[model samples]
Every structure is written in structure tokens, then in C-alpha cells.
Target: MYSKKVKLRFVFVIVFLILIVLTTFTVLKVLKDNVVYFKSPSEINLLSEISNKKIRVGGMVKKDSVMMNNNKINFIITDFKNELYVTFSGTVPNLFEEEKGVVAEGFLNDKKFLVADKILAKHDENYMPPEVKKSLGE
Candidate 1:
């Protein structure tokens, strides 16, 4: 025989917990929908099925595998075990070049080809801007 006050408090606490759980689930669902997973060329080569969803593939640009014609650029990304051909029609980052690390965001046309919408160049941990390098004298 709990008092009326105790029942009211229990109900309020239950409602608050439900709201919290709902909010958390909503946030997680949104995040999951927007997440783009990164995979290497070797990993992609092992996929059993290619999805239409967008993903990011990162690896070193194969040497002399880059070719450009007007706005479109084609290159090969390699992880030393496998390679994925990428075609992008846009301005590329300055750091993008042969033998550099790159992450291309786009949909995979197949296990060996990717149609990239964006290109992101990655630098090593020791990389420093020219100005800073000049100042540091090494």
C-alpha cells in the first residue's frame, strides 16, 4: 500500500527513463546512418558483395598510376596486396600525388573500381608546413 506521492514519483521516474532511452536510440540511429566506413584495397578485394552505399577507401596512390584529362582524374590505390581503380571528377587536394596516402569517398562500382565523389589526402605524423620546417631548420 504505497502512498499516492510514492506512485506519482515512480511514474515520473519511469517516464523520464523512457524519454532518455528514446533520445539515445534516436541519436545512435542518426549517427549510424551517416557513418562512412573506411576500408583498404585488400579488404575490399575480400568482400563477398558490393553495396550501393557510399564508403571510404584509403591506401597509397600507386606510382605513375595517376592520369588526368581536363576535370577528370583516374588513379590506382594500392595496399601492396591489392589495388582499386578510382575515378574522380573534381579538384584534388594539393597533397594528392603518387605514393601518398589518400582516402576517396564514393560508391564502389565493383570490387576493383570506385567512383569517388571526394578525395582526401593524408599526411604522415612527421609532416610539417614549409614555414614551420624552415623555422625549425630540420
Candidate 2:
């Protein structure tokens, strides 16, 4: 025959575990909807399905790729191995320029181009986001 104390302890442990599991599940589900992953041009190319979800793409602005048309700017981002075109109508950071590290936050248009809502440029020659550096391998 099992003692009452042991049965009570087992029930308590089960309830505690269930509570922990439920909390973890809820947190993960909430984060899943909010999470936006950063990708490079090459990674974007491999994606089979493109969505309008907000995301970030980081890499170097290809040399001589920057162009201006009235208030709009267009550029190409490259990971050396692959490249992606990006267009933005907003004011760009002063540090933004060709052949510099930049991260564009926006939605991809059929994986061929990114319509950026924000453009983040590197602070200096030596600074780059770790995610972007890893993607560029430099």
C-alpha cells in the first residue's frame, strides 16, 4: 500500500510539471508570431515561399548600386555570393552608401526585391551587426 504523503507528492509534481509545460508552450507560441528572422541574399533565394511578413536582410551594398530618383532610393545588397535589390522611399541614414554594410528591414517582393521600411547602416568601417558579419563572412 502506498503512503498518503507519497501520493500527494506525486500529484504535486505532476501539477507543477503541467503548469511549467503550459507556460512554455504559451510563451513559445507568442514569440513565434512576433519573431522576424534576418536573412542574407543567398538565404532569401533558397526560400521556396515568400510572404509579406516583416523581416530583415543584411549584407554589403554592392558597389555603384545606389541610385536616387526624387525622394526614393534603390540599391543592391550582396553577400559576395549572391545579391538582392532593395528599394526604399524613406529617408536613409547618413552612413548609408555603396559597398558598406547595411541591414534592410521590410518585406520581400517575390524574393527578387525588398521594399524596405527601414535601412540601418553601419556606424563605422569596423562595425557591423554580428548576424550580418556572419552572413557576409567578413
Candidate 3:
């Protein structure tokens, strides 16, 4: 028969383990909810169903596919194997241009189209911002 002190210690250890497990699970769940996955045009095309959740689609902006109408801008992102049409109604970054790598954060209306709330231009490692270049006198 274990003493009262031993039983109390066992209960304390069990409670501590349960608390740790619950905290870990809670943190994981919050992280999962906040994570925004990035996908290419080809990967998006392979999706069986489109969800209302937000996602990021990254690829090269197809040449001659950028068009502006009023406050909206439309462009096509292609991964060589597939293309996704994107519509955005905000000022794009200076680096955003045709034939450049870009990532659009938004919701997908279908496999072929995305309604972007934000646009992020991606550049190669060799690229530098104009301000930095000027400051560095390069």
C-alpha cells in the first residue's frame, strides 16, 4: 500500500503531464490555424476541391498578362505547366511586373482563378532594392 504522500506525488505528476499535453496541443492548433500555405499554379490545378480559406500562390507572372481596369488589376501566374488568373485591387509592390516571380495571398474562386488581397514580389538573391543600391553607390 503506498503512503498518502506517494499518492499525492503521483497525482501531481499526472496533472503536470496532462497540462503539458494540453498546452502543446493548444499551441499546435493555433499555429495550424494561422499558417498560410504556399502553392504553385500546377499544385493548385491538382486540387480536387477549393476551400474558402486563404492561401498563397507563387509563380512567374506571365508576360503580357497584366492588365489594369479602374481600380482592379488582373494578371496571370504560371508555373510553366499551369496558369492561374489573379485579380487584385490594391497597389502592387515596385518589384511586381510581368515575367517576375510573385506570390499572391488570397482566396481561390476556382482552380483557375484567385482573388488576391495582397501581392508580394519575389526576387533573386542577386537583386537589390534601388534605395540600397543608391545608398551603397553601386
The candidate maximizing TM-score is 1
Ranking by TM-score: 1, 3, 2
- TM for every model, in the order presented, reads 0.67, 0.64, 0.66
Q: In candidate 2, which residue ranges exceed 4 Å CA deviation?
A: 1-37, 124-138
RMSD of each: 5.5, 7.0, 6.2
Model 1, range 27-91, lDDT digits (tens) per residue? 88889735545789988998889999888999999999999999999999999999999999999
Stretches of model 3 off by over 4 angstroms after superposition: 1-37, 128-138
- Decide which is better by TM-score, 1 or 3: 1
lDDT per residue as tens, model 3, 1-138: 999999999999999999999999898888973554578999899888999989899999999999999999999999999999999998999999899999999999999999999999998777688899899986
lDDT (Cα, 0-100) at 1 in candidate 2: 83
Please report the TM-score between candidate 2 and the true structure.
Answer: 0.64
Candidate 2 lDDT by residue in tens digits, 1-138: 899999999999999999999999899888973554467899899998998788899899999999999989999999999899999998998889887889999998877799999999865547678899899985
> Alpha-carbon error at 123 in model 1, in Å?
1.1
